[model samples]
Target: MATDSASACIRQTERFGAHNYQPLPVVIASGQGAWVLDVEGRRYLDCLAAYSALNFGHRHPALVAAAHAQLDRLTLTSRAFHNDRLGEFMERLATLAGTQMVLPMNTGAEAVESAIKVARTWGYRVKGVPTDRARIIVAANNFHGRTTTIVGFSSDPGARDGFGPFTPGFDTVLYGDAEALAAAITPETVAVLIEPIQGEAGVILPPEGYLAQVRRLTAEHGVLFIADEIQSGLGRTGATFECDNAGVRPDLYLLGKALGGGIVPVSAVVGESSVLGVLRPGEHGSTFGGNPLAAAVGIAVVDLLETGEYQSRARELGAVLGRRLEELVGAGVQSVRVRGMWAGVDIDPDLATGHRVCELLAERGVLAKETHGSTIRLAPPLVITAEEIDWAIDQLREVLAELS
Candidate 1:
């Protein structure tokens, strides 16, 4: 396809597709490492990574090659027949997640929806909760995915607005507060669903030891714990699993995005066998759940994570980035909270707004989007090098200083 005017393309898309997203002006055509080149051949550093999908960066050669090879041989077998790569992927993902089983799905929302099923079923079968009274506890300001059941539990109004009558049976507690979670659960409560750091809530971190406390409390209550690591897992947060930072073992792990290496849509529910086994044959599935193409990419992604190279990179750069952000605190910067490669920077109310800073960033060759009105999230691909990190940071610092 020939590159057209980005605005024209945007108009065409808005005409056809849902107007759910209000995106920045750039329309990316190609990318490498942490940089994307738009249709007009202007380059911008990719700080969002498709909400953490591009942790390996766009069109990573190895992952692209995997997709190419798989495409040549086979793509989909519909889960009706065994594909050579699916078992390998399932095995690797399960092992990597320290879980006994893996159930593949197409999107993060599907995986989260599947998790809801697992949690509710486990409640009835294992926890002995009444059939209709299976309650799952979620933290406030959590963004699991956009499925009906998932959004039903979201604390964000915009995501859930006008989308109800919502799914019931979910309980909410203050995020990062273990005491609130403990108090919210009754005997019928089956599971506690949480994001390790509440990424969508301005990269909010729980108090130190909060995850550990959550671990202890869940264990004591025998309620399953679920970690929605869709945005933070697979080395995006300087750890294989963000829960590792606290050594918490969740009963269920929801994964997506980076699992497909930016090649295809893939998600999974990794958890103990008994809990996952609750789904009998024909209970739930997708046509492309374990397709060979996605399976191959999933395998490659797992291999990359096992090397520990990217995680180390994220860790090293994270410290430098955090220090740099801290220097901005109380300056034009209102506050900064960083975890691994992802950061949420709060803009000063008087100096400049997050949207303005992001627009200035776009002009300066760094691309980031604003969230929650005043915060801009930074989540470059893990494959970005030290030089690129410095460059992106310099770009942001320059714009922020100018705003100040």
Candidate 2:
């Protein structure tokens, strides 16, 4: 519990754990409402927010209460039997998404995998696609999840290398190019899976109308449009869903990250009955997918979003974030792409790498993350205040100034 304990903890982790992730040096011990305390009790603004998993901020009171309440009651009843909480959770989630059915899962990757399975099954059973020939078209630089099948289609070599012999039946297309997508769709194509905003690819935003074009093309071609909203949904992008911003409705929604309110790992594939109804009872399932605890936490999350306050907060504070980041364009910052409360800031390589900038910012009590080399991603919790946003920006400015 001492401040110096962080170094010991880091050393222990490095010694025992896999070296898959290179995290920032700071060791977070506790968090509450957009801020985290280190073992030393140093508080830092949580700009990354667990890659938007903590969109409601760390350990939100409502979510915590729900988790606590569930702990005292039923927790897990596997799919073999029924749990009272699962039906309500699914119904509420389906209603929130305007979908007729919900398939709950434990992680974002599982949700994505479920969507893929549903799409492929629908293709074979409903679309009359020949068996074992169904192909799913994925966008270039898309980051869906890290499972073998998910990473098999990844354009990023870091994610794909040595992970193969990978899953087949996937075709890669240039992202944001409707013409390319159309050309790639063959008679055997089952679905087009993409992220509305490519969160891991430096929060990349597609060209305007790209999503709408995808919807039109998928509808016309009789292919399912799967939107990976794990990172961009749940008020992170100033909307309940990023597809809403583009005025498009994907056939299936792959939702996770924020759905659990940072209390547990919860995800779901929400879609119309016509699409999701393809699965027979024993086709697929998870042990902890819709446990009472996860459902309870997820219900709390849906309740919070029902008020529309979080989305509005993201929109209003996002403007402030945009203005402050835009001002840095010519000052040791190369460029910035901002949508809602999310931003990807490209650092001037002549001055510093995104990792260096993040390190400097962390030293100044603002924690962020770097992606794709020189680009740093900023996604503060919606609960973050205007003053906190300004403060984080000030730290970034200072980091840039010092680097310059």
Candidate 3:
């Protein structure tokens, strides 16, 4: 139950803030490592990790120190003037993504929009497509961003409804079907944008060899393959990129979420010079894209991934997570899909909804979130211990038993 302070805060927020999100009735006060303290002084393990933005956990020392140092030195100078931090951030991020260029942005949605503009411009300038005639192929059930253009091609009605007169120039195809994707391509197609592992769509993974086929088809058709790694990249999938795990490379990588070490909002479009080079100055930019504070934290994030420690943690820990979740398949959980440290567990509709199960989990001191009606996603911080993983699953098991 919520205390007076927590209830009062929730009431005030509901009264003033927009009703966009249906957050759990928990008011977080502060956090350290994998646990957060609520207003009532109750602690809970953070399982969602701010939708994977807090991969290193809250207030990670290196990231916090980087932010503190940058805050004391400088913050934003905008693109009108160069700050001392942007160059190193861009260089380090490019090296980390194994690409030649970086087009920084402030959010995942901004990065997606920026990549769209870049792909269209590239098609018109280099691919020889007619002006305003370039088309991009996207997967169904894909969740790239909430922006108008991004949602314009979305297959989910919840994301597309009430946002209409949607943008054209996008074709929809089945996510893991190579034949459908191939058939959707045309001479006017400029790029094929997709998520390597669909994080929002219940952590759905493609069929085996699907990514390799995408690479081959794009190279053969001269179409740019843009991977929206906002939720799936940056060591979330047990590798620097899910593409790396699959041994396939894309022409452009749309990255965000954990890139700022959860210290600031930092995102970017990483790609080769020939593709990202299409954007000239004044063509497309963000005011706070590469600000000094964001850059400092981004650089620190890159440094963390360079060690390969976090990726190894995800791989080893993910196996344990998968095994525990699979045990519940017939015990209230209808199915489960896991990759790296991320999982999508589908609750049996006869038992309860995912939201109700998460609420019960929260009551038991573990915090998680539901993606759809019956699917809940689990993405703990990479720093989480094996013991903590077991405890979180234990809480889930108890919740399922109670529901049963």
Task: Give each model's whole-structure lDDT.
Answer: 0.88, 0.94, 0.94
* Better candidate by TM-score, 1 or 3: 3
Cα RMSD, model 2: 1.2
Candidate 1 global lDDT? 0.88
After superposition, which runs of candidate 2 have C-alpha atoms over 4 Å from their true positions? 1-3
Model 1 lDDT per residue over 56-80, tens place: 9989988998999998999999988
User: lDDT: which is higher, 1 or 3?
Assistant: 3
In model 1, residue pairs whose N, Cα or C atoms come closer than 3 Å (at least 3 residues apart or on different chains), thus clashing, are none
- Candidate 3 per-residue lDDT over residues 160-218, each given as its tens digit: 99999899999999999999989998999999999999988999989999999999999
Worst 10 residues of 2 by lDDT: 1-10
> How big is the positional error of residue 323 in model 2, measured in Å on the Cα after superposition?
0.6
TM-score per prediction, in order, is 0.97, 0.99, 0.99
| Cα-based lDDT at residue 44, candidate 3 | 97
Worst 10 residues of 3 by lDDT: 278-287
